[model samples]
Structure formats: C-alpha cells, structure tokens
Target chain A: MIRSEQIEPCAAAEHSGAWARRHVLDIEDFSVPEIELVMQTTSAMKEILSRPLKKVPALRGKTVVTLFYEASTRTRGSFEMAAKHLSADVVNMTAQASSVTKGESLINTLNTIEAIGADIIIMRHPLSGAHYCAAPHVKANLVNAGDGWHAHPTQALLDLYTILNRKGRIAGLKVVIVGDVKHSRVAHSNIWCLTKMGANVVVCGPPTLLPEGLKTAQLLFPGIGVETNIEKAVKDADVVMELRLQKERMQSGLLPGLRDFIAGYQLDSKRLALTKPDSIVMHPGPVNEDVELAADVLHGGRSVVNDQVTNGVAVRMAILYLLAGSREQ
Target chain B: MPSKVVITSDEMRRSIARMAHEIVERNKSTENLLLVGMRTRGVPLAKRLAANIATFEKIPVTVGALDFTLYRDDLNQRQPSVKGTDIPGTIDGKAVVLVDDVLFTGRSARAAMDALIDLGRPEVIQLAVLVDRGHRELPIRADYVGKNIPSSKDEDVQVKLAETDGMDEVRVASQE
Candidate 1:
C-alpha cells in the first residue's frame, strides 16, 4: 500500500491541460508535455497496482480489442492486464486466431472490430505505418503495439518511466541502446523519446545492423551518438539498454555469426563494470541469453528488465485512460 | 455573478475544533480511528481536524487521502484524471471518518463510500463536511457538518481552504 504522504494532489493539478491526440501511432507525434503527462499518470496507476484490490471502475463500460499480427508476450499480456485492471472489457486476437487467416484486409478487419463496439483498438501489425492506415477508418482509438520496425510508443514510454523511476531524472543522462538497432522497434521509439527528454542517446551495433540513415538521424535527434564499439558505448553510461537480437537476421547474412556477435556485444559482468556504478541495465524482452545479454547480467542486481515489464502495464493503463477520456472532452 | 462570504476563517477553525470534539465523543476513543480526506480541499480539512483532536486527546489520529475519480458512476460521460488513494494502513475493523470540504448532490459521498468498501471492510464509515449545501440527489447525509447553507439547484457553494486556495472562506455564488 502507498503511504498517504506520497500522494500529492498538486501533482495532478500540474497536468490540467486536456489530452489532444486520439491515436497513439508513434513517439514522433508526442510532445514533451504529453510525454511528461503520461509519466505522471503512470505514477498514479502504479499506486493502484500496489493495492490488494487492483481493479478500478474508470473504464467500466468501455471495451478494448487487441489485434496482434506479430508474436509478443510482454506487450500483449501487459496491455491485457492494464485493461483488466481498469475494469475495461478486453478481447484478444492474434493473426492465427482472428479473421486475418481468412484473408481479411487490415481495414476490413479493423471495421469488424469497431462494429463489435470496441472503444479502443490496440494492434500490432507487421507492416510499418499500419496504425496510420487503420486510424482513419475506425471510430475507436488506435494504439500501435509495434508496426514492423517502425515504433512502439508504449514500450518507449514504459522504458522512460522505468528510467525515471530509478534515476529520478532524465535530462543529461547517457542511455546506450545495444543490439539490432535497425530491426528493433524498441530502439527506434526509444531514440525519439529519450532524445526529446534531453537524454544523450547512443546506438551501438554492427555496421550492417545499424540503421542506414544514422547520420541523418543525428541531425533529427541532436546529441545522438552512433558507436560500433560496445565498450566505448557503455563507458560511464547512466542507462544501458539491450535490444533483443532477432535470430532471423542471421539467415539474411546481416551478421557474421552468433558467436562473433556475442564476443563483441554481449553484456556480461565485465562489460557491465564499464558503466557507472549505480547505472541500470534494461532489455526489451524475449532476450536471447548469452547472445545479446549474458545470463549473469540478465539476472544482475542492476537489471531493471522486470521493473520494465511491471511499468509496461502502468504505462498502457495511462495511455488507455488518457485516450478514452480525451474522446468525451 | 454576485457571491457572499458565508463562513470566515475564524469560524472555519472553530467549526473544525468542534467537529474534532464531536468525533472523539461519539467514537468514545480515538483507538483504531482513521480520518480519510477526499481529494483537494478535504485533505487539509482532515489534517486540521486530526490536529485539533491530537491537541485534546494527547494521541495523534491516522490521516489518509482518498481519490475517487476512478469509482465515479458518470465515467462514461466524463473521465477525470486520477490523483490516487493513499491509506496509511489497513482500514479493516477501523472507524473511518471521510472528510470533505462540501457536500453537494451527495454523489461524491456515495462514490467515496464505494471506494472505501473496495479497499477494506471498515467497522463503520462516517461523512464529515465543512459545508452542506442543500439539493442532494442521493439519500446521504453528513454525520459531522460545520454549517448548513440551504441553496437552490442553480447556485454553487464553494469552499476555499488556505491549503488549496490560499484563503479560508466559504462563499455562495449563482451559476451563470
């Protein structure tokens, strides 16, 4: 249970501005104030999670439909839990289980979900910009879980929340993201979110795994450092984030070999020693043990991967609460 | 809109001191007693009541803050941002006095009761308000009321506490 002294009414008063956006497509569309507002709301949701009775009646009559075209454990499960915690009815659908198997078009499938009276549609499609394509056709608010390698706004927000929870601040912190930067939607969204909040973000990966527009991205997100050297990237860092290495990338010849990648980028205890003493390690999970992150480092004291999962539910709850509330305002 | 001050700062303080005495007398003792204040102005008023009780009883009472934004019945019509509920300890078998600044329509009091029940099974629950303006839609009444100002449905009764509004006063103004 939360202490009565920790609950501050003035904190809620600071975010009196009404939420403006309807759909959460990407981190690029979010302003600084909007991101801060989400963080503040997530703090309140976290307090609810601490209670013995974890349910609330805020979204009593609303329905949430989660449509996933890709495989996800943490994101989908947390979103479902978030909706259930808020007392919103949730319907989960995967590509194999849904009408997508019957060759239903994305827009048509979305309309069908809308017809079922969904107040919010949380979808994870494999195609980039899918939420943008589906947002215009549906009356329900759209939240992109992950679109190809595009963006995962909720994941980014939770990562931000976890970082802020541990460090107590974000500005001027060095956050090094290591692994498949090109294929990881987590990295793409984190870059945008972290940079916007005044963090010095560094992307570390092999030349082939790094994004092609690295130079141009630096221009867009100022103070972003691209380092191929893993040791140099983690040096004196505040936060070291490890992106899961997708095994499919190896078949495409993007990497030399698994052993070679592990030798260079695996975040073992030795590699973790290079960062600041109080620095935290994060991984957007389904982590490949001993490949991207070593077993010891994964279970290390500095690891906040579990906290990230818990914060994911809170962040999603905040997103659903804000989006649903904005419709009436 | 024309408004007139109903209760001055001194009157508000005296009313809180009286309410504290009444709470102590009715409950027989402050043992296992909790003062849970509704969000915003109610929080400070609860603290003030607890402070007064501590002055006379020589034992401090536990104070908590309850935010019922999530338990609202009109959620589908409008959703307010959640401030959060924080109880210092378990409410099971404890006498809870819910403190608020004003009682209007009694809907918020109803919501607060529902919220409290969800947390734990309190031995008993009582409502306390600094002002009780008439026009209640629900069959709820405050156990401890500082003042009763009967007003029409179109009028608004506002309670400004020094902790929130930087002043202590109760005023009634007509809705424009």
Candidate 2:
C-alpha cells in the first residue's frame, strides 16, 4: 500500500525543474529509493486501475508519444493503454508508418517529435543505446521502452511489482531465472533490479547462451549464483522466471535445436516441483508453447504470467505519472 | 515548548459518539450512507464514526479511504506516497461523508471533494472534522466539527487514536 500524498506534486511544480532525473533511460541509472518509489507508486496506481471507471486525471493535458521502430504487440499496446488510462493524450508511432520507413535518422525523428510538442517519448529501437544516443538530441523526457537487447525497464518494474505483491517482500527471495540469458533484455533488467533489491538472482542456461558478463554478476552481488544445471538452480527457489527463447539464437548456433533446448530446459510440471511448494512461475511472454515451458505448467495455478501483463499497465502508469510530473516542471 | 491536551480520551470518545448520532439524525435514514476518510489520521476516525453509528442505528455503514495526492494543488511543495484508495461500493446516489483529523486551510477537504466527484456522482458530499482550526485558505467549511479551537498559525493540532497511534487524545502543540 502506498500513500499518493508521499509524492510531492506541489514540490515538483514549485521549482521550475525540480525532478532528480529528466528521463527514464535505464534501470542501471536508478537508485534503490527511486526503484522503491516506482514500486510503491505502482501499488497505488493498481488500485486506481481496479476502479469501475479505470481512468485518472494525473496526466491530464500531458502528451506521451510511444515510438516503436521494432515490431511488438504487448509492450506497445500496454504502453498506449497505460498512457491513455492516465488521461494523457497518446500518439502511437511505428517505424513502418512513420518517416523512419523512408530512411529518416533516429535522432531526427525524435527531434521532430519534440518539435511537435510531445512531452515525453517512449521509444523501442533495434539498436542498443538507442535511448542513450537520442537523449542528448531531444528536449522531451525519453523513456527507453525496449532498446535492442539493452533494457526493457518497465517490464522489469512490472515483474518486480508482481513478485512483491505475491511474495510480500523482495529481500532474501531466491529467484531462479532460466532460459536464453545471453540476449534477453528482460533477463538483463531483472538481474539489475532483483540484485539491487536484495534478492538472490540465479541465471541458468546452456554455457553458450549464458552471457560472458553474467559470470561477473557475483562480483557486484555476492549472493548472485550462476548454474548450468536447471535442477540445482531451481532447488528451494521462491520464484522461477522462464525467459523466452529466440529462434535467432538457434540460427546463430548458440543452441543446437528446439528439441534439444526443450529437452534440457523446458519448465514442465515435473521441473516445477523441484522448487518450493508455493513457488510461482513467470514468463516474459509471447511464450513459445512447449519450447520455453510446457503448456500445462504455463497455464497452471502457479503461473503469474497474466498478472505480469495486467501489472504492466499499472507499472507503466507509475513511470509515466512520475516522468510526466517532472516534465511539466 | 510543552504540548497541552485539548481533548482527553473520554472527551474524544463522547465527541465521536455525538457526531455519529448527529449524522444519523441529519441523514434521516441510515440507507446509502458512505463514510470516506482522508488518508493517514482521517481513516481511523471515519472507522470509529462508522462503528459508533452502526452501534446506535443497528444498521450497516460502509467505510472507505480516499487518497487525494493526485487531486492536491500543493504537490510541488510536498512529496506524498503511501497507501492506495479503496471505495467499498458505488458512490452514486449515496451520501458521502468525508472525514479528517483537523481542518485548517480546507485544502484537503477540497481535494477530497475533487476525488469523490471523479469516482461517481454522489447525492450529497459533506465534510466532518474532529477538530476545526480556523484559517481556511479555500472557500470551504466543515459541516460537522467535534471542537472548534481558535489558534494562531504557530500552533499545530494533533489527534492520536488507539487504532493507529496506540492512544486516543487530541493535543495542540506549538510549532516553535
């Protein structure tokens, strides 16, 4: 439970530019209090979302532009709905329909959006650091929706919020993340957020799919555990987050075949029993049925994948509300 | 430097009991009565009032909590964050009684009214404060006041309830 009064909207407006950060570029840039603020604020937003008329005037007169240069369904749709729910005027822009299809540069299009009076820009691009590169060239508050394999911060926030709501706490929880750990921006962001929040994060995958930098995760967090054995990784865990396997990883030779990946790492009912009895299962979906997880386990009582999606709106609303307040100042 | 007790425990109880009876008398019938408290201190007071009313009228009364952070006009000066807003049922055609600890500038009551209107159109919205300290900055006044204490800007009125703060008392302390 969060008191909306804890956020000083008046204090924010008193100073012309009072917010600590102008943009939400990465989870790596956020401190513990900032993350907690987002999580706490999200709880309040979730309450508002549950109302019969699920809309708030928090972002009234504010404009949020979601610009996607990549193909997506859930993320784009959720961002649009979250912004609209907050009463912010939203403009959805995809690469195919926008000037980017005609070879317009990323920075140029972003600047044009700023010139068009977009108070904030939510961007998803193919190249990593797309948000980082575009931040300097625009005045609008830049939110990195999902930039290549770099970060999907709002997704991570929702995942954290979901876990917090279910578990009642994040500290000291054993969260075993299993799948293509190498290229998953979801995994990367989760690792940063979980470890920062004091959760014991264990990343498990084939040695090839495990990113080389993941080994150093323990350097930053002594409790961070990396395992190649799925059974060992999930044993006594409080949560098991299964990552989506990209077909591109197989084409790039990181995995042998879909059959081999399923044989080695598929989260079926049998594998779920290895974790704690009350352990919840999660997947950053567009789930590959029978690939990342068995269909039964995915739809089972222990699954919170749908809750993750439902929470996505609340989490994004918190981000937009916080950023929109700052951008107004 | 020392604080003075304005309303003792027994007196606080009697005041709330009286307010409950007054609420029932004015509304004519207990039907469709919803008590909504402003967050922090106001919540327990509203619950107390609801409990007192239920005891007297032998009827059910709905109690809810409203967080007016989004509706506040002074967000730039104070950072607010706490619990979520929970309304028990539809407020349409129901008489909503907004409750709080102390009424000062009347800004909080104003904000609560704004939030209540957004939820649904109520038959009538009324303000009830445990203590009313005169210095209203807005064109708003409380309909029900337990006690009206004339005080300067240099004094603060604080209410403590056993449910939230482990005691039941009201005190006026000097700001300095």
Model 1 achieves a DockQ score of 0.56
State how far residue B68 of model 2 sits from its true place (Å): 2.1
Residue A129 displacement in candidate 2 (angstroms): 2.2
Tens digit of lDDT per residue, candidate 2, span B1-176? Answer: 66899999999999999999989998999898999999878899999999999999899899988988777776545445635687776889999999999999988888889888878889999899999999999999988999998889989888899987899998888966
Query: What do the candidate models score in CA lDDT, each in turn?
Result: 0.90, 0.85
lDDT of 1 by residue, A278-312 (tens): 99999999888888889999998999999999999
Model 2 agreement with the true structure over A7-107: per-residue lDDT tens digits: 22222233323336779888987877778778767877887776667776667777899999888899988989999988889999989999987899999
Residue A262 of model 1 has an lDDT of: 97
Please give the fraction of native interface contacts (Cα pairs under 8 Å between A and B) kept by each candidate. 0.54, 0.27
lDDT of 1 by residue, B99-143 (tens): 999998999999999989988899999999999997889999999
Winner by DockQ: 1
| Candidate 2 structure lDDT | 0.85
* Model 1: per-residue Cα lDDT at residue B94: 96
**Pairs in steric clash, model 1:** none
Angstrom error of the Cα, residue B33, model 2: value is: 2.8
Candidate 1: lDDT of A35?
84
CAPRI quality band, candidate 1: medium
